[model samples]
Target: MSPTDLGPGGPATIGAAVAHHAAHIPDHPAIVCEGRTLTYQQLHRGANQAARALAAADARAGSRVAYLGVESEWYYELYVACARTGAVLVPINWRLTPPEIEHILRDSGAELLVASEDHLAALDGIRGDLPQLGAVVSLAGYESWRAGRDPADLPDTTDRQTPVVQLYTSGTTGLPKGVVLAQRSFFAVREALADAGLDWIDWQPDDVSLIGIPGFHVGGIWWASQGLVAGVTNVAMPFFDSSVAVGLIRGRGVTTMCVVPAMLRLILREPGVGKADFDQLRKVVYGGSPIASSLLTEAVEAMGASFAQIYGLTETGNTSICLPPADHQPGSPRLAAAGRPYPGFAAKIIDGDGGPVPPGTVGEVCLRTPARMLEYWGMPDATSATLVDGWIHTGDAGYLDEDGYLYICDRIKDMIIVAGEKIYPTEVENALIQHPAVAETAVVGVPDDRFGEAVHAFVALDPGAQATPRDLATFLKGRIATFKIPVRFTFLERIPRNPSGKILRRELRERFWTDRVRQVN
Candidate 1:
């Protein structure tokens, strides 16, 4: 769709952003996947074709469109097309099982399901059960479906407040909640930066970006939007793989990328990883969970790349706080902080009573930002509890330092209250990782007759390494407090993590707490 093609106002939402760039810089590279590169002009026209096909299939304003596929050019095109109409997108996690996928499809009441070949095979048995699902469109048939559609004009059904993407939460504690984000959610940061003229947040037209994270998370789709808004070239990865990422960085002149700590750890473990060139790589942003300082230090020295730490939740739409590259020094106090709030964003620590706490006082982290999500789909009570008076209660326990940098402690529900003492698992896990033999560890509080609740740990050791409960206990004695050390340690082949690299502590706690009525002491 061209600027003249738009009835009146030209390109207001994300779908409009594509048309905006296409009209201004029609030939610039927009997306690169496999061996194909799509220019802005091609992206705009393809999205228009997709919009027509979707509308023909009974999709219109307020329709729910679900996509089950790996990261690809078509996935993004559908996103832009949905913006052309008022359809909301629910990008399903490809790693989910049939039952899980069914739950999301039913919950969202999705009318159209667009999937790749592999996902189609996985859902062959369960697609019949989805009564609300109207038609399933495969990427193989996308071109055929849009062959006769005209790209000159499209339906105008977009508003800044209209929901765009419905991102499901990581669900570490329970079933995933769908976070509904409006068109303003993705572009507020960009709009704010444009007004402030911040050099650190600026994106250059020549800079190449790599989107290696999974599409199910806000980070993946939101990160891709930045490149489009800047009219830069983006290389989309099917998923994050160590060897594949290394090859892309060295082979494609990749400059910027987003990753979680687990991906960084895997990248560090790959054979001959040090020999790989990172000269072209500039900045790497990581979030989704707390990272160990050891891993952070090692990554800094190995890649020689600037690192930025982001802190946010799906409910917030995007990162409210960012620890920029300058604050990621070896022993800087700010290294442990989640960094200050971004421009045009405000963050504060508040008590349980909903009153603000003084700096250095621990409480809940609350944020007010333009990127905040509109609501959790069909979850009115949850939305009411989370969003209060334009402030989002993050549900994570933390404190703002004197300099306003937020230091995340732990999830308030995940914190262990043992004999009136509070213990955060990340603190204990960080100490355990300091041991040479320990590769990964998860700390939880178990029922104990003596102390009411005793710390217990599930550990995964380094390859060919051995360690006993006594070894880790002794190792952690001086590193952390004695009460925080694990009383019992069980070795595991590997720790379970979500696609976004968040540890599922609830799964681990289920087996131990099944017979009991409650989880905590």
Candidate 2:
């Protein structure tokens, strides 16, 4: 299809977006990765040729094409190529164990894998277990493969509902599940923002965005696709390093980036970070975990940029709730809130009975958005359980205020019941992180005969800082209720977190509940 055939609604599909930009602004830089820059024309032609390469490897529409590597231009090219061929791109987390990687490949029934040379070793022993895998291609040989095919666009048979990307869950609670997302997941929010004239997140003509989050996660793909669709320059780092990211932001003149809270914290702590020029950095969008109030203030002062907080999951197509720049005042009460929903998005709190709760009542947060995921791949029961009647039951436990602001207390499964009193781990963790001696902390419920279940905390102290358990408990006297104070404190060099930097409370709870009959009290 020609670029004009995409219609005036704007490039609503991934393939259409790439093709449209190529026809209109062919010379504009599309991606800059590892000292190499690819313009829109190059990205478009490269994706077209890569789509032909997929066909040569026997991949067809609906086939799963797996990719194992760090973020790069090749990964993005394959992302658009999957769109062109109506195939599904499965991005495997590079940090996963070999068994975990094998599980996703086997479960997805991927026909072909394109991995970087660095990761070929991980797949060596497991290739025999994957009977459906037809062929494997190294990133080093990608150019030769692309050069063998014709640089032409494929037929645009795919539509908005066609699945293009399948991202696995972080597997914090259990084994990772494939989250199938359609083309609509990437463009719906942009269309909604345009119709509402909201700049909660915007892509300017001169914007240069940094792809800091890895491609295996939803946040990374969501942010990167935005820059491509808007026809702007995107600078990608294969992996995140505070020092390298700081240098790129200053040296490359990166204007905006999307990162988790942990990444922002590390960036601020980089040695000699103050010497870098951040004048061109315009916006810093962060999410993934709750940011301590002090860190938020510190980031605001350090970056001197507009800050936006997005709240969502892999199942919600990345972001349904956004805390815009205007609400980021120094002492505003809404600073703690998760912000209102997008123009076409809706959120409501529901109690145990699955009925709507009154304002300010903590309950499960459900969302109705145009960008929600299609379903958990091959899991009908799970699809039904999570997505019911056009609403997504986000497992997050939060409340809505009178003004419609979302206040996320914690994950529902992470809530601890202390003598029948509900205690959200985030509240205790947030309070603990405020202490001068604490660098990071995670709280869980441990079996206790007296209280049925008592708050147990795992902490990582700041370097050279010392504080006894009693000192911390005393520090929490007025901040939280006496019952909410942690009964046992275990200090560690660092807390275990998943690749996305989310605390793995399940791991901590495993130690305490190993001999118990049930996980809960």
Candidate 3:
């Protein structure tokens, strides 16, 4: 392996430069959050102190530490502390139910849990069920614990290959799966970002980044790491609110921001949306789901040409595919594609037998990259199923054109079959989103006696716009083949989505076929 590959003393591990920046940029703003700002020196000291506390509590390297908090400066410090101590940081989604949270806490064998005051109540309800959880530290209580400790001499024992994070899958199907990402995986993502022309969005000493996505997701964790790695300032919001995001961008002169499609839609719909100058904004990275071409065009017009798109999953670090600013043209062919594979990442479509598919033939998208996850936590069977012959089966159905641009068709499991024809939900959803009345749409397969499975759509309309099921069906009838049109349409106030804004088709299907013997194939 090259020296650039993650190992001891490599630039990929947070410990590689933590002390360097802590001493050099001690006074530089490391994080700006909720009217309070922390300098690099403070962050370093805070993380060190937290590490000492964990050590004092018998937490050792490779130990699991569950972080149960919303976005906060303290949350970042805890993450860094885990990295410094060689502990696996497992971030729990605050949106999950108590039982769901309990399952992760137990399954990961987490001995330490750092939770916010709001989340503490939830933990209290399930504390008795988690015998393995040794300690529950509250963010609000950390200050008192560190009052007497000297943080400068805390022990640092991080190794480059050590697992840094265990991110749980969104679990739209069943229980969430834990994806283990090592320090090497993170370093690979940073290197890929630099190699993919995204270095221009690199953090500077004075740069403040507005983080709108939930810290539990990849967008928040990876982007936050990018800022920290460059010793730049990061401004975090506890939860997503369009007015607050707009205020931070304009008020704090935020130079960079990471957002999801729904967040962008909310920001664009804000009443004072057009009033914000956003002159300080340098780049707006959008991902998590396929972005509508129309939304991309409007975003460029609203936020300038700073919008960039990234495509990746938790199991593949954070970014493997990137559509750079140069590809954001009004009618560029690349806009329809998911851009090119990141440097050091090789992607291809494979058929049922695992043979490479020819260009333009839809199949499973497989990736081979340094940034791939170590394994699915405690799931050797699933891991073996996904990672075969050094390639990660992405389970996404897409084709690569002759130019090597990736055109994502849909999820392999989400393909709708109607009257012997295959219909991709993303295609139908993409076409539906173009309509002015539609805000969001999710397509799923529903039971039908004639057709083995029929295409069904659940839509959320734009504010003050009304459209019936027949109207939407008629709108799509001419755009696609007759077989591809949705057989049933349900107008909902809002579609159910996971924390990352990916629509929950499994939930939609369960409502109709939960009791039926024939569940989704």
Candidate 4:
């Protein structure tokens, strides 16, 4: 894009980017979903109509418009439409329960809701309970709803600092918190990277990217934003399924995709994946949790795609620390690290007192980056506690090496203190999964009068495989330190996790602490 087309400050906003592409590449493919492809012209026209409809519904600059649906052309149109009208889009997690959905709608003060037919039904009884909601429209009849409206001119309303997305954190601890992300925090950093001429992995106009993760995640929207901003064709999968994903990559010639570690593991476990053609795939970016180096090794061997690991929180734009393609080789020590920060991002480890920790010492990971969120909506205390001196206090515990590779240990809250020894659950779970019969495992700290807190592991056995807790305990005896070994084992049909694929240790600890006043021992 030319400097004259960018939004007054130096970089273009998402709305500006889309407008530039529509004007220059009108015939180019933009979004493909459910067998229908929308060219840039179609996408822009639909977004124009949606923006006019929403504008008529009283949505203006800074107004909130919530959406409840799986990914589709309608979803993308509404997302861009919100940018055209300067309304903030809140993409709801369709996997969430009705009450949870209601909580987010209320919390975001969403004035209008655009939902799929099924999602609209999910809010049937609770629709009246929302006081700030001005209207709710169903995607099933979205075309008819906008029938009378003509394609309106793109409004010159939004700027880089406009809060375009308000992503609510998946509430594992309690109620989900809204993490407000502005265009500058989301796209300005990428603009900086381009200015620096760093193009290790970037969106090319010819790239056919895949949007597979649920749109509720920052990574999901952020991934799609890259494709949209760069004028690349994007294939939108309603949801990520291992089998369906392989087909999309092979059938559509997908060049890039962003996925979580669990999704990659599942795809590898899928039958015939070894024989599948991945010659067209250039990059597969995984994040939201640390990829077990063992799993990463297998993925690297199976798919020809270059693997990159991104580490960040919803509060920090999509990614600040990235393990680039060069560091993904098997046996590379950097594979276990979260790579160095991006060109414009900086990070450090801080002790409990907020002072810097020495290199190689584990502490709370803190990041100062252009992509950091504005604030946690309605959470002044949390915003204050998390954002200090322009640095985001990431709850994750990790250490930075001399070469600047950051190695993640575990969440500070999830760290188990047993008999004065600190035991990160992932360390124990990693050792447990090495057992042949162990399919999945989750480790959490449970109350114990003997050690103040005891480690308890929940294990899911492989199909048609059986192993007693004693057998697994014997197997783990020499693998990890005895102090780090789980004190108790409980068999489970499946391990519980949030949608983003992070294990819900709090859910596993609930049964053990049902009668206790506090969760902690």
lDDT of 4 by residue, 255-345 (tens): 8888876677777777877646577888888776555556778778777788777878788887888888888766777776877788878
Q: What is candidate 1's lDDT per residue for 1-521, written digit by digit as tens?
A: 32223334334788777877788779878898875788989999999998988888998878899998888888888888887788999999776656667778888989999988877887888778888899898878877877788887575668789998898763433356789999888777766766576544556666788886676778888888777766788898876778888888788888888877667777777888773567787788887665667788988888887888887877888788889888888899788787888889999898889898999898999999999999989989889989989999887888898888998865566765443334667767877888999999898877664345668899999999989999889887645546567888989999989999988888887787676533443
lDDT score, candidate 4, position 264: 75
Query: Tens-digit lDDT track for model 2 on 1-521?
Result: 32223357787578888889898878888999988999999999999999999999999889999999888999999999998789999999776657668889998999999998877875799888889999899999989977868997777778999999998863333356899999999988888998898998988888889988888888899999888888889999998878889999999999999987667877888887873467899999987666667779989998899999998888999899999999999999888888989998999999999999999998999999999999999989888999999899987788999989998865666766554344678767877888999999999988765445789999999999999999999898756557678989999999999999999998998987787534554
Off by over 4 Å in 3: 1-12, 153-155, 171-173, 193-201, 415-521
Clash count list over all predictions: 0, 0, 0, 0
**Model 3: per-residue lDDT, tens digit, 312-369?**
7777887788777877878887887777777778889999998988999989998887
TM-score of 2: 0.80
lDDT of 4: 0.80
Per-residue lDDT of 344 in model 1: 92
Error of 2 at 291 (Å): 0.8
What are the per-model C-alpha RMSD values against the true structure? 11.0, 10.9, 11.2, 10.8
Q: Where is model 4 poorest over a 10-residue stretch in terms of lDDT? A: 2-11
Greater-lDDT candidate between 1 and 4: 4
Worst 10 residues of 1 by lDDT: 1-10
- Comparing 1 and 2 on lDDT, the stronger one: 2
- The list of candidate 4 runs beyond 4 A from truth reads 1-11, 171-173, 415-521
